[model samples]
Target: MALPWFVKRYPDLNFPVSFPPELLSHIIRDVCYNHDPRHPAFRRACCRMTLVSRAWQAVANSTPSLWRYLLVEYSTSQLHLAAFLRNSGEAPLFLCFRANAPIAADPDMVRQSLLESAVYISHTIRRWVAIDVELKDASVFHSVLLYLASLPSPPLRVLRLACAVPRHADRRSSFAYGFHGPTLRQLALDGAPPWSSPSPPTVALTRLSLHQCSWPNYSDFFEFVSLTSALRHLSIGTVRFAGTLPATVVHLPSLDHVDLLFGSNVDSIPVVASLFSRLTYPALLEVAISFNGYGSVSEFLRTPLAFRASSARLSGICSIDEDFADVYHRLFGVVTLDLSHGQRAMVSALSAEKSHALPLPSLSTLLLYMPNWRSLLDVISSRNDGQLAPLHLRCNYPEHLAVTHHLPHIADHDLESHHRVLSLVSSFSWIHPM
Candidate 1:
């Protein structure tokens, strides 16, 4: 057999004349695995690897892991899908089915293609370890759901399903019943029903992310949370809620990270406040809350549960009063605080003169987005006393540059000492424009 194309093309260059089949297989797997099967480059690379040499072809064909990831798209040929299924052997599969219609393609053709691929893949459902299905057509989405519902449960670890169709147009039934994967660890749903399953695969789930989903009432949501006792990280974005919440609080002992983002709905204030009041996660390490609505930070801070999170982010808060600051100081052991869309009132509250006790005493890192330097300097100066730890400030590019330029001109020796305590980090790209 001839050497690889690279070695043959560059004959003068020193190349290994022979490689242990195991070593060669590892090399090929690493190269192929780097690109997801959905990417055209992955298929091209796999084809080129087989064409490299007779030995390479044998190794590539024999390694079932190399052919385990199957991307089934509307444009994908049945022959290619069959080849992947055959080559994968008994290895666990990572299947991604994208039923999005190609540009200018007939809708009927797209649906037919998706149906065909779905049928082809259904035979090997038990071998699937992870399944990601993205469908744009409502009919196709429903069809796929029904097909999955009829199939026996797979040992799926990760399940991500996204539907682009509008909610109103889509049927209002629980799609969760279609999926029954007891081993599922991570589940992400976008524009899909959250939980309708009488027995969901929630017990094993560690991470759950819901975007643009609505709960019929708070009880369903709480019940869903109750089932997912092992959940460690929960993220809900722009979720719509209805009905009143129960007075009782739900305890999640294992939860460590909670992220909530409410869109431009003023009604979400009550939902946000209710979550803060209802959920108790003692081991929580990080909490991020953002809402584009007319809600006070004080209302949300009225929860009885005190979070020991070292890091906290509060965005879209236009003002923070001393009361809010006091509550915040009591609620969280926040070592790092991000106030991206903060106002002057918030800065004042952080630097408020408190003779008895300082607010946010544990705060060591402060991240702001394009904050007024004068107000920020005041914060640094006010907290510079021996009582609290020195502040580490991070700001956007323009503000950092401006501060660096003006720092030398400030002639006050005490202020210079304050500046010395600050470790100013200019996270240029990370801090986006408000």
Candidate 2:
């Protein structure tokens, strides 16, 4: 085989006629630092590189960035853990501790290991830029919380806590305390853990997600949102807000996306509406809402004036209770429209308009959920204008099999119609017998 141009030009640079040491060093550094820390591929690649040779092993061990993310478990040795942290040098650290792990077959050993790991991690808490912890027992979690309470605000940017204890666990009070990270921007809490202190300073978070987290009262929840002045994205799932929403509007100047979901509560719609009414987020661009409460979606829809007037986009609206007015149709400019589960009467209402104002001009995807073949054909026939952008039609009923027979002849089988038409027929059974 012929030598490459670089190898030929600099004979001394070639090490065993392959990768130069300088190039190899750069590649290894990039692989370890740039790859996603959570991906298994990262660990697999690093492990493979270490087996290459003693030179590669030395390089991997000396690279401070490679050991920055540590998973301290019961099986992890204190000596090895200390060496890993020391090798990480001054690089910002990401630490994860699972306090519920059992050590060997002994429960006493497990407790001792948990205590030892928490104490060791606390000593290095100032080096942590992000922390994720999982604690199941109330007593162990309370002890860990004390160490976390003493954490001095360093470069901590993300904190995620998952407590698997029961809702009535005594340690819940300790979990309610706030972290003291001056740079914390993202916080996620799951399984009923209170993530903030009693008097949390105004932290300008950009993203906040809460799943099944309980607050002391409605005021506390509102106060938390108010303090996050730089918040841009917020997600709430199955989190209940008690008492009436504050009348005062809280403005989030940078907010761009909001997602609210509800699983239980008869007053979900009103509660969601009340929350929306209290916020003024002029920069919002996308919104998603799911509620199984009393009243139709229209009630919640009417609450957010910003959603309608602002240039907000949605994935798709998928509820069909009653036909909404044309004004609602005019407000939406979504690229993908899923009206399959929506009321069929909406098509009639839209077709009856004399203006034919092209309500969904931006629409590129349309789904039809019809009772029979003829209804689907009727709706498709009503849209005679070929000026529409290319469309993808998805049919949800088996009876609409007849559609394929006549689809080729639609619009007189014109070239423009063929180019504009795209059909996606469902092979599965999502349609029920009416």
Candidate 3:
């Protein structure tokens, strides 16, 4: 087999190798797969492996899995693309096609090159396990979508499509395609095409993420999700909803993780309530919701959506009324609470005296980003009244020593002072720095 151009250029350079071909192949696979395929370092490392030694080159050439991840760009030469595809053999491929605004002298030629590459890969659609396409030009986007739409059914497991055009731009022509893959398990769409067809064979999907997508009505959104009964993770952000709210409540028995984000639009409040009230997921264990609009946090808390999660992250809340205290107390299943963003009102609500019951009685962990040490101290002391388990607190304070002095009331409890880091799980820590 012919070596890649980079490897052939350095044919005489060989490094000493002690490990067997099998072991070396295993090491190379681990290193290459761990890093993201879109990163330049990943491709560079994959090419560099062949130059390590003749034994390494032979092993790399023989291993089909090493070349299965193909990143095709506008500048990717035909030789490189063909070499990777040939060496990948019949292994399921993870394909990523990126077509950004070209800086080349001949912009039309660059786009044509991208279109040709898309057509070239169309023959291998049956072996595609995952495909991620990101395009900035509308014409190029339409061409790529056309190629994908003409392809036969693939064993695709994941599909992510992103369009960088402005929302006001005419995207109807570019996004007028439906995706259908029975084996698809993950789908992520960002300013991309909408699946308007009645049924597009997404029954096996376990994760769905939609960002900056608009629907004609609320029912359209619900109707799409009602199909993914086996979905485990659902994430929606900055999605626009219109028309009357749907009465149908979609039941997702297998869903466990949900992340929602609302932009600064007052109309979203009712839509948010409608969405939460409509969906019922019994297996849900974690939820993170952010509100960037003007509305009462209590309005969403009043929804029938089960807040029966072990951990919950709530942020972007501006204020809370006295009724919020009552609604907040209902989240009895939440053991860990994250109030790291604009949630000082929540701290006050938790600290407030209620003649009936304590807010979040089952809560044992608290993550706060409050600058006020006195209020933080007050809440900690109030919650540790011996009725509930000791609160494990993690927060950021300007003066660590000053906060430590004020913590004499609940000093015996598990207290952690974070300078710039909060110990919340990386996935739940979506709040940007203040």
Model 2: per-residue Cα lDDT over 287-347, one tens digit each: 6554423244455456674254333322224443344333345444443344543435445
- TM-score, per-candidate, Cα-based: 0.58, 0.52, 0.59
Query: Global lDDT for candidate 1?
Result: 0.47
lDDT of each: 0.47, 0.43, 0.48
Tens-digit lDDT string for candidate 3 (223-258):
555554456777766667778776766665566777
Quote model 1's TM-score.
0.58
Candidate 1 local lDDT, 228-306, one digit each (tens): 4456777766667789878887776466776766665656656666665777766777777765444566566564423
Off by over 4 Å in 2: 1-59, 62-65, 73-126, 134-152, 162-206, 211-215, 226-230, 262-264, 291-295, 305-323, 330-336, 339-378, 384-434
lDDT of 3: 0.48
Looking at candidate 1, what is the lDDT of residue 42?
51
Q: Which candidate wins on TM-score? A: 3
**How many clashes (backbone atoms < 3 Å, residues ≥3 apart in a chain or on different chains) does model 3 have?**
0
Ranking by TM-score: 3, 1, 2
Backbone clash pairs for candidate 1 read none
Model 2 Cα shift for residue 136 (angstroms) = 6.6
